[model samples]
Target: MKVAIASDGGNVAQHFGKCQEYAVFDVVDGRSENFSYIPNPGHQPGFLPKYLKGLNVDCIIAGGMGQKALNLFAENNIQPIVGISGEVKQVMEDYINGKLTSGASLCTHPDGQHHDCDGHC
Candidate 1:
């Protein structure tokens, strides 16, 4: 599976929309295949989903994200795991070892728009 971890420096980004980059890791049979850090292609509404989808990402791990972003991932069948923090490599290891479990969002949307919360888009 291909997992994308929202990153800021070396830790998990505080917010998905505001993340500086995404560390794309490819795992096959529980073994890492390749990894790369790609700068975010901008988070314009409805655009990032398409961009990420095109990259063939199967999952997205982040600290928090807007409901719309969650919906976007849902539409693409990409699992969205939020409320994650810590080193990117460790997070991936936890995930691979089945020790990683998601929790509620840790950050809030700054725009205060309709796409704010509600857990739905």
Candidate 2:
């Protein structure tokens, strides 16, 4: 499976749409391999899910995600795992070990406006 983690400066970005890039890993038999980074193309409504899907990403990990994005990912057959935080390497380890699980969305946009949260989300 291919997993992508929304990242900024080697850590998980708070908001997936606003992230600087993605840390992508190809996993086989519960082992992560062939890591790479993909720059964020830009954040437009319903764009990212399609973009990652095009790249054959099977799953996405992020600190937060909007409701619409979550739905879009589902439609694209990409698993969206949100409410994650911390460094990318550590997060990857947890995911490979089956210790990672999603929690509540950290997104604070009730009105659906994309605003900078200064990495606090």
Candidate 3:
């Protein structure tokens, strides 16, 4: 499976659409490999889902995502793992070990703004 983690520097970005880049990984037999980074093309409504879909991404990991983007990912058959925050490598390890669990969506806006979470990401 191909996984894409919304990233900023070496850590997971707080918001999917506003992330600076994506850390893409190829996983096989519960192991992750072929890790690479892809620059965020830009944040446009409905654009990212299609873009990642075009890249053949099977899943997305992020700290938060708007409802519309989540729906778009669903329509594209991409599993979205939200409410994750940590170093990219550690997060990937957690996912590989099946220890990662999605929490309540940190973003409340359909437009991908960081308006919720009580200023605590």
Candidate 4:
């Protein structure tokens, strides 16, 4: 399976729309096999979903995302997992180990307010 994690400077970006890049990880048999970074094309309405689809992304992992963006991913046959945080590598590792789980989206407002309480992003 191939998953893309919204990233910024090697860590999970808190807001999907503002992520600097995507840390794409390819997993086989629960083992990560490859990793790469694709700089974000841009975050215009109705753009990222299609862009990620073109890359054949199966899923997207992020700390937070707006509902519309999440729905767009679903429409494109790409799963969106929100409320993930921390270094990109460790986040991917936890996912492979089945230790990561989606929680309430961190950026509920999506109006650019109070999303990064921890200031990691």
User: How many residue pairs clash in each candidate at the backbone level?
Assistant: 0, 0, 0, 0
Model 3, span 1-121: residue lDDT tens = 9999999999998788888999999899989989999999988778889999999999999988867788899999999999999999999999999999999776656664555432222
> What digit string (tens of lDDT, one per residue) describes model 1 on residues 1-121?
8999989998999777678999999888987778999998876777766788899999889998777788888899899999899999999999888888889877665565535434322
lDDT value for model 4 = 0.84
Please write out the lDDT profile of model 4 over residues 1-121, one tens digit for every residue: 8899999999998888788999997989879887999998876777888898898889899988777777888899999888888999999999999998898787755565544432222
Q: lDDT of all the models against the reference?
A: 0.83, 0.89, 0.87, 0.84
TM-scores of all candidate predictions against the true structure: 0.87, 0.90, 0.88, 0.87
Better candidate number, 1 or 3, judged by TM-score: 3
Judge candidate 2 at residue 49 and give its lDDT. Answer: 92
Off by over 4 Å in 4: 110-121
- Residue by residue across 1-121, what tens digits does model 2's lDDT show? 9999999999998889889999999999889999999999988778889999999999999999877788899999999899899999999999999999999877777675656743233
Please report the candidate that would top TM-score against the real structure: 2
lDDT of 2 at 22: 97
Better of 2 and 3 by TM-score: 2
Q: What is the lDDT of residue 27 in candidate 1?
A: 85
| Candidate 3 Cα deviation (angstroms), residue 16 | 0.3
In candidate 4 the C-alpha lDDT for residue 42 amounts to 71
The count of backbone overlaps in candidate 2 is: 0
Window of ten residues with lowest summed lDDT in model 4: 112-121
